[model samples]
Target: MTAAAVVLAALGAWTDYPELVTLGLAAAATLLLAAAWLVASPKLTVVREVRPRRVFEGGSAQGTLTVTNVGKRDSPPLLVTETVGGHRTTVTVPALTAGHSCTVSYPLPVARRGRYVIPPVELGHSDPLRLLHRDRAAGGELVVHVYPRVHILASITSGGPQDAEGQTTSSAPLGGVAFHSLREYEPGDDWRHIHWGATARTGTVMTRHVVVPDEPRQLVVLDTGSAPYPSPQFFEEAVRVAASFCVAAERSGLPLQLRTTGGAQRESSGAALEFLCTAESSGADRGLAALADLLRDVVSGTQGVALTVVTGRVDTEAAQLLMSLRPRLLSVSLAQLVSPDNTLPARPRGVLTVAARGSEQFASNWNRLVLR
Candidate 1:
């Protein structure tokens, strides 16, 4: 445009045509106006929020951007570029009158498991003609942690308790087959015993935490070494499998020990799901080197705690390690995620092994094979 304008002006001067000169001067004035329009930056205060920062996989999260016009003049419309990890989305914020505020909301993707950081929005301004543009940083980083989807695989049965699948307690156990005190609903508590009568009377959901004799604490170990998995997908399935066990423990309202072959261990901690959100497959068989020490610690200190190992494949050495740890616990179970064509090594005689192709298969296989 500048070149064209200069040429028009030069040609008009040489040809002595007044019309060409007027057109060039008009074009230059328009360009200058566009620049001047953006020179007065919009004075705004921006606040960004990620509602329900922690969500399950396959679920979605929402982000809201609030912009307030703090200047004496009206604020121009803005273009906000929101970033979620490597993905980016741009949204338009409507103009706001002085001392007023407007909010722009957008969806954030949580389709996969892991931690994602949503940084501050980049506030953008442009002239109505869209010629001149500028952007300034507006807010701070908001973190969204995506957790594994816990399948409602196990049905809540009216049948006798029998220590309910995952983990348990002291001489006082977990169940409603026997009556106990009632309390309000907590996230990890089982939905089976929702004291309907009390819930109706009080208008609040409640559950009965019945106590029984001789409850067992459980240890769930995830084999995170890379060698066991033929592909990355199998490792992810294994993670979901491990998470299922932890969630079961939570539902049972008992103590659970969660550990990984990479030396990451959580003792009956409620953050097992959070820990697995960022769990990854590391290099070499050497990554499984810490499994023995981690298990040995649990074996020496605790008693009557059942053990379950979730893995991708059971190799000779891995099977041997599990076999050696079997004698110290009351029961040992193995959950393996393997490809359709892969052949698994022979599991120890007393240890139970359930093989599956994915998280769905793992859940189905566990119900059919172990529950029976």
Candidate 2:
């Protein structure tokens, strides 16, 4: 357009046409005014609010942005762009008079599990010609946590050894303080252990039998090595399996320890879920060695600790390593994500292995296991 205006001005000078010169001058004045309009800064305030700061994977979250013109004079309509989870969406804000505000709402993407940061909204000011524009950031960044999907199972039985007295397993170990049952008093029974009420009712001396308490502890190891998984989906399934195990253990009142390539923790279910949300596959093969160290340390300190390992794929070397841990662990289980038609090699005698295509199948197979 600038080139055309210059040509018209030159033609008007050569042909001595007053109308052509006036038109060229008017075009130039219009361009100058548009540039000045775009160069001026916008006098507006922005505020953003995110609903349900935490959400599960594949869920939906919404954000509302309110833009207000603080200047006494009316402001031009502007464009507001927001970035969330690495994606950007833009909305048009209508012209606002002094002390007036316009609110716009947008849906945030939650297809994956992780902590996403929503940056400040960018306000774009431009002229009516749309030839020039300026963008200014407003407000502050907000963080939202996306947790993995947790499935509820009917029951999760401990695979550890049972008591010889045929006592039912409990979440905590039994002590003499916890009363179990009363039976006929034996000659060597302490007088304090005798139940006077039972003896009076049955016309025989009865002694209280206090069963020993047994607390189950489980260690969940998640392999995040990048070399094993054939696709990202498999790795994601592995994470979900680990998260499910954590949730199950927590609900069953069992002490659980979670180990991943990123790190390890023995906190509550919330902490474990947070870790899984941000866990990523690593190219290094250090997870196996880390698992071995963790198993050795845990076994040396605690006896009859149950262990479960989750991985995307299993090869001869990985299988052998898992098999070797069976001796030190009271019960060892392996969950591998693979194709439905894939056949795994024979597992070790004491090691329980379950192969499935996804998290749902894996949970079904795990729940059906009859661990001795």
Give the best candidate by lDDT: 1
lDDT of each: 0.78, 0.76
The total number of steric clashes, by the backbone 3 Å criterion, in model 1 comes to 1
Off by over 4 Å in 1: 1-29, 153-215, 268-270, 285-289, 342-345
Prediction 2 TM-score vs. true = 0.75
lDDT tens digits, residue span 99-132, model 1: 9998889998778999997778899998878867
Each model's backbone clash number: 1, 3
Task: Give lDDT for model 2.
Answer: 0.76
lDDT of 2 by residue, 239-296 (tens): 8888888888888766677887546665567788888888889886576656666566
lDDT of 2 at 259: 82
